[model samples]
Target: MIEIYTDGASSGNPGPGGYGVVLKAGKHYKELSGGFRKTTNNRMELLAVIKGLEALKTPSHVTIWSDSKYVVDAVEKKWVFGWVKKEFKGKKNKDLWIEFLKLYKIHQIKFVWIKGHNNHPENERCDQLAVAASKDKANIGIDHFYESEQAKETLF
Candidate 1:
């Protein structure tokens, strides 16, 4: 089984954001992280899981560890399925959710929620990666969908 630990951070609700993911299987391990010029913590949280799953080269049983209830409960509690049936109307991060579901269907996945900043070793490492990525201006990427949506919101 593959185990993935993930975390996300943002300087502001819609400010600089990043996600960190640590993937472990048997003796193999990998870390993944990236920063966005403007995004939300919740987006980063979900994206961390997405990135972890995406990195897998084949289908397998996977356990995802996350510190965000927004990411965990939505899957564990089946809220995302309901949102899907409704075509994701009134939902935030539709782009990411759709992408996640596509990858999710290709593998067996489980989610475990943990308290943030609680001193868990893997979680702490993920948090550190996420925070550092968010602060890395040189390598920051753009969340085009998010930025465009925000631009539209400001026009109304």
Candidate 2:
């Protein structure tokens, strides 16, 4: 079984954002994260999980650990699929959630909730990655969800 730990951070709710993912399978371990010029923490949180699952080279059962109730609860509570069904009305992180469901169909996934800033090593590493990724020189791209909304406002 593979184990994954994830975390997310945003300089402001709608400011620079990033995610962290720590994956361990047997003796293999890896960390992943990246920042956006503007984004919400929720997007980065869910994106971390999607990225980690995509990183897997083979099909395997994965146990994901995350401190975000938004991410963990959405899956555990089965609200993710429902959001997709409703076109993600009033829901955040729709793009990443869609990507997550795709990979989820291919792998056995389980979610575990961990308290943030605890003594867990994997969780701690995830936090560090999130912070570093947010400060990355390459912004990659600004989150479109917010940018689109902003565009709409300016058009008025």
Candidate 3:
């Protein structure tokens, strides 16, 4: 079984954002993180899980540990499936959710919600990685979909 711990942070709701992930399988371990110039905490939260899952090279039993209810509850409570039937109308993060479902089908996945900033070792490490990524200026990347969507919103 593979275990993944993830966390996300943003300076503001739609400001600089980042996600952190720690993946462990037996004795092998890996850490992943990325930053976006403009995004949301929830986006980063979901993206952290996506990124972690994407890193897996094969289908396996995976358990995801997350601090965000937005990510955990949506899956655990089966709300995302309902959203899919509606074609994600009136929903945010459609792009990410679609990507997640693609991965969701390929692996046997489970989610465990944890309290954030509670001194859990892996969770704290993920939080540190996320915060550092969000503050890193040189490697920051653009979240194209989010930025374009924001632009369209401003035009209306």
Candidate 4:
């Protein structure tokens, strides 16, 4: 079985954000992370799970550890598929949710929630990666919701 640990961070509530994923299969471990110039912490959190599943080579059993209720509850409690059926109205993280549904069908996946900042080694490492990537000067990714929300804020 493969194990994946994930975290997401944002410098400000709606500022630059990033996602981190640590994947382990057998004895090998791989780390993956990237940042968007602007986004919300929730989007990045879901994206971390999506990217981790997408990284797998074949349909297999996998367990995901996340410091996010947004991601874990949606899956563990089966809300994600219902939201998709409703076309994602009134729900957050639609982009990552759509991506996640694509991979969800192919793999036997399970999600476990870990308390963030509670000294869980893998989760803490992921948080470090996410924070570091969000602060890097070269981040090029864009978050549509981030821009949209910023536009709304400018009107106030």
Candidate 5:
């Protein structure tokens, strides 16, 4: 069984943000993280899970631990599927969601929610990684969809 721990952070609601993931399969462990210049915390949260799953080279039984209720609850509660059935219209993070669904179908995934900042070692480490990445301006990349959406909103 593969266990993945994830966390996401944002300096501002719509500011620099990043996601952190820790994947462990037996004794092997891996950490992944990236930042975006402009994005919401929720996007980062969802992206963390997506990245973890994407990193897997083959289908496997996977359990995802996330501090984001938005990500965990959405899947555990089946809200994401409802949105998908509606074609994701009027939904935020449609791009990421679409990508998530693609990889998601390739593996058996389980979502678990862990309370944030509760002294959980792995979760704390993930939070630290996410915060550090969010503050690293040099390595951060543009969140294209978010930037384009902002541009479109400003034009009207």
Candidate 6:
């Protein structure tokens, strides 16, 4: 089974943000992280899962651990499907959730929620990666959706 641990951090609620992922399968391990100039913690949280699943080259049994209840509860309780049925109206991370579902259907996946900042080795490592990425000026990337949405909000 592939075991994945993920974490997300934002310097401010809608400021610089990043996601970190630790993926392990058998003897193989990989780490992933990226930062966005303008985004939210929830977007980073969901994007971490999306990125982890996208990195898998083949379908496999996978288990994901995350600290974000927003992510964990939505999937664990199957609220995402209902949201999709409604065309994701009034949802915040529709883009990431849509991306997540696309990759999600190709593999057998399970999610477990863990407490953050509690010294779980992988989780702590992910948090470090996320925080550092968020602070890395040269590597920061644009969150197009977030920026565009903010622009729209400002115009209206």
Candidate 6 clashes between residue pairs 3 or more apart in a chain or in different chains: none
Q: Give each model's clash number.
A: 0, 0, 0, 0, 0, 0
1-156 in candidate 4: lDDT tens per residue?
Answer: 999999999988778889999999999899999998888899889989888988999998999999899889989999988998999998876777888888999999999999999999999999999988898877658777668766887999
Query: Could you tell me which 10 consecutive residues in candidate 5 have the lowest summed lDDT?
Result: 71-80
The candidate maximizing lDDT is 3
Distance (Å) between predicted and true CA of 65, model 3? 0.1
TM per model?
Answer: 0.99, 0.91, 0.99, 0.91, 0.97, 0.98
Candidate 3 lDDT score at position 110:
98
Expressed as tens digits, the lDDT of each residue in 1-156 for candidate 5 is: 999999999999999999999999999999999999989999999999999999999999999999999989888899999999999988899999999989889999998899999999989989998998898989998999989998998999
Q: In candidate 2, residue 67 scores what lDDT?
A: 92
C-alpha-based local distance difference test score of model 4: 0.89
Between candidates 2 and 3, which one is better according to TM-score?
3
- Candidate 6 scores a C-alpha RMSD against the true structure in Å of 0.7
* Whole-model lDDT per candidate: 0.96, 0.87, 0.97, 0.89, 0.93, 0.94
Residue pairs in collision within model 1: none
Arranged by lDDT, best first? 3, 1, 6, 5, 4, 2
Instruction: Go through the candidates in order and give the C-alpha RMSD of each one to the true structure.
Output: 0.6, 1.7, 0.5, 2.0, 0.8, 0.7
Q: Which runs of model 3 end up more than 4 angstroms from their true locations?
A: none
Candidate 2 weakest ten by summed lDDT: 137-146
User: 1-156, model 6: which lDDT tens digit per residue?
Assistant: 999999999988999999999999899999999999889999999999998999999998999999999999999999999999999999887888989999889999999999999999999989998999999999999999889888998998
lDDT of 3 at 111: 100
10 residues in a row with least lDDT, candidate 1: 128-137
lDDT of 5: 0.93
